[model samples]
Target: MTRRSATLAVAGALIVALVAVASFFNLPYVVYSPGPVEDTLGEWNGQQVIRVDGADTFPTEGVLDLTTVGVTSADAELDLLTALRAWLDPDRAVVPRELVYPEGTTAEQSRQQNAAMLANSQQNAEVAALRKLGYDVPEKVVVDAVVEGAPADGVLEPGDVVVSVDGTPVAAPEDVVDAVTAHEPGETVQFVVDRDGEQLTEDITTIAADDDGRALVGFQPTPGFDLPVDIQIGIDDRIGGPSAGMIFAVAIYDTLTPGALLDGKHIAGTGEITADGEVGPIGGIQQKIAAANHDGAELFLAPASNCDEAVEGNNGDMRVVPVETLDDAVTTIESFVAGDTEDLASCPAS
Candidate 1:
């Protein structure tokens, strides 16, 4: 072969190697895709998603699914080929890695943030649901149960609201525990409680716990609001983030009240709920909407602030309704069930 032919062949080989490297190299971006859609009104592993004790739960009909989005984890590597595929797919999205995992964020830090958001979301969901039903759930550290033949049996009652322990202000159940554990076994701890609007002071002798050897007050302290009923929100622990807050509140309300909230119609939604029943926008709304659409939801509840993006991408197979609060969600569901969907708040088309 001539020298020119040999040079051209070598250049071609180098180009091929570069292309191969580009296809296999990790990219500084993440892909967003549809994830699992869970029915809030249904059960997971034979356990109800929303468990209610000390309250009557009626038989609920139809579906209330909470949507999720699948995204590349902070620790996961994304190649150029994968990013190209995602960019080509209309249902999926490719975003900068910093937009998702953020700069200087570790995988463990991302997981911890998600876990914290999930916990706060659940607490807010419980409070919003109960308060929407006209039940006042005050924020306080209340005695839930007193152990029989234990240190607090005679001194503390189930309905007593713990004000303070040993003169320290009690903001949460942990506060009471810290105060009690500060004392050694067999030590008396002073507690001030409000019983039926009447304040009273009592002293309870601490006992050593068999499991951890920690001092025990013999009463179960609930850190959240003084809920009248025992409300347990159970879902897949693998699910993280606050996007399911509105759906959870709606499902809990449906379980505690009479008549079906969905009326046999399937629905899905995503939002971050506050203690005041306000719904906030969440990330990956487009991906969540796609998941809901793929799961055959007849209606979708969207945070009012997310209307633009939700309408732009999600399949119009399901009606996307904008809701600003839990009250708006309830109203939207009721209207959808009543066949009065004409006047409901809707997202403008993109």
Candidate 2:
């Protein structure tokens, strides 16, 4: 062969090798895609998704779905080609790795945090649902976390339900903090807690807080409450997050109420719900919208903060309703079922 032709062939081979290597080069980004939409009123693995005891659950119709986003695990490596595809795809999202998994965080640590959040979200959902039904749920202080090398490290543990502090009954977390702050640094404070149905009292020394010149027990406490009825959510262990809290609360309320709230319409939504029924924003709003659309949902309830993404990423005919709280969601559903869409809040398209 001619020398010129031989050089051209070599150059072509080099180009092909470069493209192949680029296809396998891992990127430091994660991809978000549409996931499955699980109907909370339906069944999973031959069992009902939401089961209630100690109360008469009424028969309900229609769908109350919790939408989820398929996210790449923090430990999973993404290639350049996949990231490029996700960027170009309107239904998918490409996010920075650090945004999804913070620096110095391991995959196991992230999973454990998600699991803990899921547990707390379930408890909060129950509280919200019961309170919406006119049930009184008094809050109590519970130990959420213990700091290492702190005064309450070995003395207090997570899941310990605090009943009183310094011989005074503590009803709220702030009360516990106030009781501790009344003492001087290095002074011992008595704490009465119920651990796994057993009452125990322990004295822990107080430490000085760095932010304020107040005494602290070196433990994080959160508000908790007892439920009148037992509520069980039968979701897969792989799905762990607080994003489904709002949907879970709605499903529980529907199951306990007299009639069907959905009126045989398919609806899907995602948001973090607080005990006071506030709906909080979550990540991957676009992917969640796609999942609901793919599931044939006629209406999608999105957090008010996510209206921009929801409006931009919506490609189907499903109406995206903006909701700020659990009460807002229930009212929207009722109005939609009654065929009154003029008064409902919808995502504005600019």
Candidate 3:
């Protein structure tokens, strides 16, 4: 072959390699996709609580005691790319995607996503079911912190209505999630909140730094609630992650109560647990069930909406309980604990 032709071929191969690398790293803005239609149970105390049975409330810690958890922060595009790369290839080339976040994303977005993913997952569904008996629902907020390193350390707190972040006003909860996640951690962000009778301004530090050496602040601007049953609810769009909080609440309550909620049986679940006992469906239910199976849970409690995904993703060794109302969850737990037929049926499909 001619030298010129050989050179041209080499150039073509190089071009292809570059394109592959770029595609691997290139993160793009996903079209704004809204999740399931949440039927608004409406405004009592500015909370949108879906009244279901069997869910109970839990208490809150003075400061978030999350020594056992891990956290990361980045714009939406960056985060999505990070996940994709991890799923695709964790050790090879870091994808070349530009850090593009959903328009108007902020720190609040990261906090909410993380909270939803982690905190609520650790909670007990039966304890969450307790919220219904008291007629209480989850509270939504836009927070602005007025203090730091103390009780009001983060600007976003319980009962703060977030209007804008760093001058970007978000209209929906996802918007807030997207916005807060747009920045690197450790960046002090200004949040404008409508707190009760007046407007307040608060700044929260971003998450701790990642391996990339980006700044991160390990704080979430969440709202916690005090229930009639000595339970508390902690929720915030500012601390986006997952629903481990609700799960943690339930687990703690179960451990502290007389009989064990696990009943010497293994169980697993995934969902966003609101302070008001609402169990909202989450993404990747199939992955979560696989996680449960790995953990050896005999039963898997999943949101009714995500039941199909959980069943399809599961290996079928575990019984899947699709819970809707807090009451339904409690009944299931009681039945499981007593090893007796509570004569309970599955929650009505959402």
Which candidate has the highest TM-score of all? 2
Write model 2 residue lDDT over 191-295, tens digit each, in one string.
999999999999998888898868988999998898888899888777888999999999999999999999899999999999999999998888898888888
When sorted by TM-score, best at the front, the candidate numbers are 2, 1, 3
Q: Tens-digit lDDT track for model 3 on 1-350?
A: 99999999999999988766765663443321111111111222465222322444332221111111112234434344455545453112222333323445565765555555544443333245444333354444433233355323543565567677778875555555556667766567677878676877777666644566544333344443333344333333343345443344345445334444554555555556655466777654555555555455555567787776544453356666777644456567668657764464432211
Candidates' lDDT values, in order? 0.89, 0.89, 0.48
User: After superposition, which runs of candidate 1 have C-alpha atoms over 4 Å from their true positions?
Assistant: 1-18, 141-223
Worst 10 residues of 3 by lDDT: 32-41
Tally clashes: model 3: 92
lDDT of 1 by residue, 164-244 (tens): 999877988888889999889999999999999999999888889999888997998875576777888888877889989
RMSD of each: 8.4, 2.8, 14.9
TM-score of 2: 0.90
**TM-scores for every predicted model:** 0.74, 0.90, 0.44
Error of 2 at 256 (Å): 0.4
Q: Which structure is stronger by lDDT: 1 or 3?
A: 1
